[model samples]
Target: MLLEVKDLHASIGGKEILKGLSLTIKAGEVHAIMGPNGSGKSTLAQILAGREGYEVTAGSVRYNGVNLLDLEPEGRAQAGLFLGFQYPVEIPGVNNVYLLKAALNARQKAAGKPEIDAVSFMRLVKEKAALMEMDQSFLSRSVNEGFSGGEKKRNEIFQMAVLEPTLAILDETDSGLDIDALKVVANGVNLQRRDDRSVLLITHYQRLLDYIEPDYVHVLANGKIIHSGDKSLALQLEAEGYDALMAKAAG
Candidate 1:
């Protein structure tokens, strides 16, 4: 397994959100987590990313045989874990290209690799932007500053491409995107899929699954994955709604 979460429990400010949740993801696989509002779907992503204020009181998380809980956010990133936020943060006065270069350099240094210079780095940036159909001008702008919903999501994928993490977790990346933008973002994600990479997509709607085609779909409720199945489960949930699943979970 590339990623493992065993009986994980987490809370924020003394409010428990995840209770005894567990999951395992292997390389080359895509997993989609679906749930209704307030079902702790986002909490699991946040916990995996090592976001602040989410206290894990129980269970263990291992990434490639390393203790994930012991690593800080930056450590996780350096160890090849990427989390695409639902709301990409805008850092004023920081050019997107420069930010990406710095992030790449940080990871490289941690891995004892030589830093990529300007010329080589721009070559990579251009190649990835073209794959996503993003305009070159967007790279010169501040990180996600003044970007549209779709643009921000694409930017997140752009960062993922540059980072090339072993595991990527996307949190509601398709929430506000229209059909066109969603397709573009999904295209970028699909392009990054490889035999050695893994993706965990957290979403409330099935629209994204239509494009991304997850290998597994897990239904989460009240902090636990109450049900899990193949892609057909997502289609079934979209058709039948969560009421039946919720009832089954409660019973």
Candidate 2:
């Protein structure tokens, strides 16, 4: 298994958000979790990324057969665990290119590799930026500051492209994006697909799945996975909605 989340339970401010959510992702698979608001999808992503403030009351999360929940946030990144945020934050006064270089170096150092020289790193970034249809000017601008919603989401995908994580969790990445921007972000994600990489997408709408088709689809409700099936389940949910899915699961 590339990622194993077994009987995971998490809470925040004394409120339980995840209730024994178990999921396993093998190499080269794309798994998606779809749910309505307050279904604990984002919480699962945050806990996996080692975000603080959430208490892991129970469960074991192993990545590559090693304990993952014990690692720090940066450690998780170095270990190739990536989280694409629903809302990419703005960091004023931080140049995007410089910030990305620092991030890449950190990962490289963790892997016992020498830091990439400026020329080589820039060349790589330019190639990826072109692939994502990002303007060169955005590279010199402050990180996400004054960027439109679509731009921020695109930047998140761009960061994902640069980092090249082993397992990626995209939490509502399709939110707030128009059709054109959504396609761009989806294309960026699609281009990253590989046999050794695994992706977990948490989304509410089925539209995004149309572009980045997942191998499996799971339905999360009230902090638990109520149903699991193939990709066609997303289309079913889109047509019938969560209420019907919940009813089917209830039966």
RMSD of every prediction: 0.7, 0.8
lDDT of 2 by residue, 116-231 (tens): 99999999899889989999999999999999999999999999998899999999999999999999999999999999999999999999999999999999998889999999
Q: Measured by TM-score, how close is model 2 to the native structure?
A: 0.98
Local distance difference test scores for all models: 0.94, 0.94
Candidate 2 residue pairs that clash: none
What are the models' TM-scores? 0.99, 0.98
Task: List residue ranges in candidate 1 displaced over 4 A.
Answer: none
Candidate 1 whole-model C-alpha lDDT, 0 to 1: 0.94
Global local distance difference test of model 2? 0.94
Task: Kindly list the per-residue Cα lDDT of model 1 for residues 150-205, writing each as its tens digit.
Answer: 89999999899988999999999998999999999999999999999999999999
How far in Å is the alpha carbon of 55 misplaced in model 2?
0.3
Measured with C-alpha atoms, the lDDT of residue 185 in candidate 2 is: 97
Candidate 1: 10-residue stretch with minimal lDDT? 45-54
